[model samples]
Target: MINKLSIVKLNPIIIREDRKNYIVEDRKNGEFYEMPNPAVDAINLINKGKPLGDIEQILKVKYPNEDIDIIDFANQLLDLELISEVNGELILKEVDQFGPTGFLWIPESVSRFFFNKYSYIFYISLLLFNIYILLTNHHLLPNYKDYFIFSWMSLNILLWLGIGGALLILHEFGHIIAMRANGLPTRLSIGHRLFFIALETDMAAAWKLPSGKRNVLYLGGLCFDMVAFACALSIQYFYPTGPALLLAIMKILVIDIFIRFIFQCGVYMKTDLYFVIENISGSYNLMENAHHYIKSKFKKEARKAGEAVYEEEKRTIKSYSVIYFIGVLLTILVFVFYSIPQIITTMSHSIDRLSSPLFSKPFFDGAIVLVQTLTGLSLLLYSWYKKYRLKKE
Candidate 1:
């Protein structure tokens, strides 16, 4: 016997009869709900106006899994008078793309592939080999002309730079591995950052994880670089002059390692150090909010007017912000101070070369410099524009 009244109360679409089970449909979401067979039989008996105790006995004999107190199920059925009860229900829904309103989501696939596995071994080996080459021949490594003759020149620079680029890719892989180890998702991509180079790993999900986990992921790449640097230093000190080329290579290797450390400190680019600072300050959305603030200033309008910004969303107005700002500023200041002097000196020499009759063909050199400068400037401007646009939205 089924309770037509209870079925009707649960939902208008639920129909009861002397059939196998009761079928309930959710009209709002266009979804279907199937009640447990025992429950359905009980409803069927009730619809036939049978005693509740008799229906319960029949249900008990047929479905052992439904042995729990009938009162619980009855209460749930009563509550569902406003709607239908569903278990493992299916409904078509739109995917959420905005990513939890304020937070970012790092895709799980990348984290699984890059971080949770030993895929980074390839990159580590490559870096180790390069370090070996540099330690073995420091002098010949930096002077690009030593290995290049006309035909070889075309391919050699690409090959060498390709190796360097590969190490950078591996560096990002280190971050990914760290993130995955700490139960965070991450994705790696190669792009340009101003006049410099860039390899980015999206560890946005790390914000949801604990601070220690976040720090491990953030510092993993630098840790790898530091280890390589230490090995190179050890070789230099122990072996002294292994070979002329090896020594030269080591010098160049050390220079590159040092430069990478410098680049890692580039907070304006939202590098590892930037994220670490954000994590330390308990402001997961600091960078995003700062960027938003900067964009709003440019637009002369309040982008998120009347909306209360979380402490995590506040920019470097407080102590943490000021500290990170100053650290990044000082890093940039030192880089500029060292680089500008060298660049000026290089330009003066290039100009002198342009004036000399013997080296009058300055077109190639000028083109190279122009291309490098333009490429760098374009990347910087584009990155800034992207940040501004993202914050504005």
Candidate 2:
């Protein structure tokens, strides 16, 4: 038990809010802890160096009948790193954000003016216009030939890099704008998510927001991507004689962005939809619990088990588990029926390029091809391995 007579204190915790909840952010550790209103009141009092006994007495007098265990409450905060002792000791554990490298933090006041509700209205209008254009001019959509008709080198790669880079920036900006609209100061960072490098946002502030607004933060990126594709398609339609490279670029954007949008539905991938489902169900550990349900039902690891799966999240997780299973099955089918063939075709093409003696700059081209082949194979192996591991579990 914490000493009732001893001093308790709040760390450098920043209290913030959104539509649904209050979150106490311990910035020193990049962590946020959700708190009830009473807990928030107690913490703020503790921040001023209130003693444990005095804080409990104050809460008892204020609420009269509520059972307020200030010691246990403070202990929980201590566990979450939301509060610390004032004895001048240093923290020892390692807690890192996804990517803290060369982080770019735009002050909210600087960008808040640009991200009001009107901005979303403009995005929606542009989206509607794009839809109209697509209906009236279906001929403008890109074809497979558009991708390969170019030199696919030098300027081609440069333009693709530039455009794709800009799109990704806009994508991250969408998240930043969403946070700003919700009155949160957001820091955008570049990070490595597993094997792939990505630009990510610090939406820890998002924990305080309502699920509706939380989803806005998630959907914001795809909005930018779609708007970009719509613009690219419009440009391609107006200039049939426009650089074939633009067509190639349009094709690339369409394929990449659409595939990415679809990929987000992979609850197993911990995509945006995964969080959306979690928020909708009010279960933060939905996927983890879903797997637990799977284990119990399938008797995979439960053969040695006797305890029941906790029901706190069972109803929500069971429904989610079914969807999760469907997503996994679809992903497996996609890999087996589609991805393997594409990988083989690309590998064959690369092999032929490497063997073609008359090809200029064969070494440089072969290196790129080898990297592509290796990446594809690595992804295939990882996917199967992950599936195998889950089955074993």
lDDT tens readout by residue for model 2, 110-162: 55554556767777777787677767876654333333433423333345456
Q: Each candidate's lDDT (Cα)?
A: 0.54, 0.64
The best candidate by TM-score is 2
- Give the clashing pairs for model 2: 20-210
- Model 1: per-residue lDDT, tens digit, 199-268? 6776655544445556767877875675566566667667886886565455545655656666666666
- Candidate 2 lDDT at 390 equals 67
Name model 1 segments beyond 4 Å from true: 1-167, 182-185, 191-195, 266-269, 287-317, 354-366, 375-393
Query: Who wins the lDDT comparison?
Result: 2
Model 1 TM-score relative to the real fold: 0.49
